[model samples]
Target: MTTRFLRSSSVLIGLAVCGILPQLHAQSSPPTEWVDPDTGHRVVQLSTEPGSESLYFNLNPFTPDGRKMVITSPDGISLVDLATRSVEKIVSGRPHIIMVGRKTGQIYYVDSKTENGATSRLVCSIDPATKAVREILKLERGQSVSTVNADETLLGGTFTERTDWDTNSYFEGGPNRRTEARTADQQRDSKGQLMVERLDKHYPMGLFFHNIATGETKSVNRGTDWLGHLQFSPTDPDLLMFCHEGPWHKVDRIWTIRSDGSDLKLIHKRTMIMEIAGHEFWSADGKSIWYDLQTPRGEDFWVAGYEVSSGVRTQYHLQRDEWSVHFNVSPGLTFFSGDGGDAKMVARAENGKWLYLFRPELLADRSDGNLDTKGLIRTGVFHAEKLVNMGKHNYALEPNAMFSPDMKWLIFRSNMSGATQAYAVELEKGDAK
Candidate 1:
């Protein structure tokens, strides 16, 4: 089956004619609603704050009922009512956001304070409706919480012990580490170098579980492989998934372990050199782990899935232009969303600057009536549809696109208005000119 899919030239011309060219400046009060000329999708700016942004692609920022979404901005953490699109600042100061409780409908975050050159992080949760706050625990300077379990009984995170290395050394020699002193290109290169250094050093880190009720913390797994991206399964309270953080091509990347720290198993084994897989996320049902897969580092792209129980694999191929920084599935699994990357991205995808909606079509089975060949790995392709033109947006701020709980909109962040802000594109494209 052919893997390449071409976009329309007329749509590109339409976008250019609409003044949606690259590097468009910000407006004091950008339009709240507008129809995307490239795809005719109705795009809505959800936040009024200049630097507002949604949670990371893997994090769940929506409340259990899906009526409210937790967003962060220069002001603080806020809640957006999906029905009315009203924004309310629920938390005042800039606290590091953890994740919303899947069952409790509470917003979890970390409030930090620096005293005598030492920082203390207080883990807390807030009720959006009642505006009540609950303090969970205090973490040491190097300790942090990343995720809450399915039942909201435990918090999962990692702690690093880097006594031998100067923490400031990561950014010390890199053009002064100030935003004003370094261009985005230089910053990107500097970060890449820091990652290489960290990976080569194999810094000591450990995964831990914090009991919210007992206020007890227990170390589960310890390693020097640069442990990061800790996430608990949305369905299973005891199952936790984490990654060996580094350059994607260098590490095994994904692994799963019990909350109590047993059964540490690598999810994907590299079959060939330069084969890389990372940016993994769980399916809505938690039955499969989906991730970006590249064979020989950027030559080909795929969104691959692995069944945890059956050990089966499925891969959906996409064109170079369809490759996204992050991909998310709808609640109903009807379609997938891609926050496309820029030209400077690893994919080097020119004209890849668009928010895309993809319909996955599974390739037909080719068993040839052979029982032995049955149940082989399934392969498929994505039918891409452009939703929002991202040409004017900067790639430095990734558009971590995710589906709304109702699957009606794709929520993402963009700096098309000169400052990072949250935006959503309606899936139905209703009455969009």
Candidate 2:
């Protein structure tokens, strides 16, 4: 499929989501195009690859200029030039790292050995222009969720000793490493049964800060338990966040620290009323941490935000109609989007996965109850064109949808054609949208 269009139904957002908003219709700039009834935005598909398209959620797929895209597969790393619609293979095998420098436009990826093997991992930076390769950091431990600072002078990394099967975690309790141990080392256990049973040791996961210019890698902090979802603050280059990557109710899901490793502090702790907060992301300006708030049993679904400096929090509660796997805010900070509602659509179906946008400003007077607002809409529903067992594994394609840095477009991955490829949808302007 080169491109297929989806028109908004004359659905009432208030009726579907319990009086969340008034009746709204899609206002498409191109009259023939589909306008999202929720946000009144246009949606477009940017790719139709025949094989498979994969992307990491923490990393922004767009390069410095948004002219190129980066993706990976079992075959290796591939680059897509958005303007020319071309694909270039950068590496042969799946690397340990895949990232794009925000300011320098340097393509950074890693080549590594298996976790049980005694080999070093190489973190490489490639100049997209010259295709020159530079090995920046070499270490015995593997890195996950590594990202660059806003200015690109430094890189933040999370190094965990847990032997994981898949890094792109969208679900839990499938082919569990601890229970389904493969190696002799995995059969044994240490203090912790599950993690130590999977690996020889349960060393504390280390969070590192690497200076690009100085060629120095410093250990900022390390934890003995599960830790991941590490990300650098967009506005504050020296600050970063990590979490105990487990059930939200079992652990404090959000924490923040500095590059020098000092001032290590927890960002959010669950209270009796608000018992969980995970799937966290920084605000556009880095002033607050935005996340979904819920109870232990997954009731009281809410889109929440916390001001980092003032310790004040604001929440916009959505009706308990359906649940979304993740929620992301636009760079403009005017709307928030969620996925996974209707479950009937297959790879080609867009039923349960709709592009839901909610406005927080309209709920200014409310804090912790069902939000009564008008800026709610379902702009689009996403179902992959085709589904494939990537790498011949149990994993299937997941649409890690995100807004562009400029917030003018939304980026998502799917296998609508034969292959998985990156796709973009144009957004309407502030006034007309």
Candidate 3:
């Protein structure tokens, strides 16, 4: 499908203009088009694909340490160190669930290996310093641990299976002749349960916690909600957060619980048939959780932050562009990608644009800094556009804005010549002073 963006000057100013005062609407200026200030250009393009071929790039949450990026390679879970920018193969096969510790730089993932010719996926880890991948524990074949703590001490994961039943004999009517409209995975009973022939088996899909320090793994034993997108609390490593995609045919979930499998609390729920803000996250102080939800008509997306104690939810609305604005992926956030809701970096799906930086101070308060949030907002940077409906889209942009450890240089990835590469833009000299 085609995506469109709105770039009216007023809207761009509306989003980018957040400060001490909250304006009711934006005033018109020339459509603030997205241009690299240094080169004076519009549209930072990446990749050499013919015409809008989807290019896949992953953001490494653990890259801050300059050690490794957790990536899925043909040789299994691989760690690419930015210092060397080299991909090191740590294990082989589909290590489906992979996580990297932001503080300790430890990498964890799921590896399915052949033991006596039988295959199973297990929770695994790789130490960047030693370049070693080791198995921690083995669960049922389909179970995979998806998140790990920064210290590599806690792990969370999920497992799923299908329960099927026969339709011909169970029905009140005589044996049915045809089952035309059913795939094995699609057929379900009246109560939303799978129709399986055995009639006695229950598919126990659940979430679990692992004490990496003790090697003692405990099954969470929650209901059949498909649990995933797990992470440990930054402040209290013993706490865990996760999203549950209820039943095989349901939407996403947001939840938080303790590592020892106590106090399972459902944070958010929706009846929609989409991922919702299912790629969920929590705030640094464990006071809130954040997630994304697509608009009801799928016209746009919204980012949400939920206060853990008060259960107050706040939604950040993103202004949409009327012109085709194709978005294939969600902008992956940085340190906040895990349990703590603080997100440092975010990626743009359209044109592979990136806005990477960490501003813990700004997020702590309500002051929206130099970012324009109203127009073409991705990864917290706003884009202002002109022509209410089309050309010269205004963008409240911080082109190539990445922060140093102390929020110094705004490093960004640019492709002026159509080759994706890295570049850094120093904040206006006096801005820091």
- The candidate that achieves the highest TM-score relative to the unseen native structure: 1
Error of 2 at 7 (Å): 19
What lDDT is reached at residue 42 by model 3? Answer: 33
Residue-level lDDT tens digits of model 2 in 301-385:
6667778787766666665432455667776567676543333211222234444445555333443457653333212222221
Model 2, clash count?
11
Model 1 Cα lDDT, one tens digit per residue, 75-183? 5899988877789999987687888899988999888678899877798999888999998988874576788999999998888777764543543211111244565
- Report lDDT (CA) for all predictions: 0.82, 0.58, 0.43
The numbered model that scores best in lDDT is 1
Q: Ten-residue segment with the worst summed lDDT in candidate 3?
A: 336-345
- Error (Å) of candidate 3 at residue 368 is 22
RMSD in order of candidates? 6.9, 11.9, 15.6
- Model 3 C-alpha lDDT per residue in residues 212-232, reported as the tens digit of each score: 779777876556544455667
What ranking of all candidate models by lDDT puts the best one first? 1, 2, 3
Better of 1 and 3 by lDDT: 1
Deviating ranges (above 4 Å) for candidate 3: 1-60, 63-68, 83-89, 92-94, 161-202, 246-252, 269-277, 283-287, 294-301, 309-312, 322-433
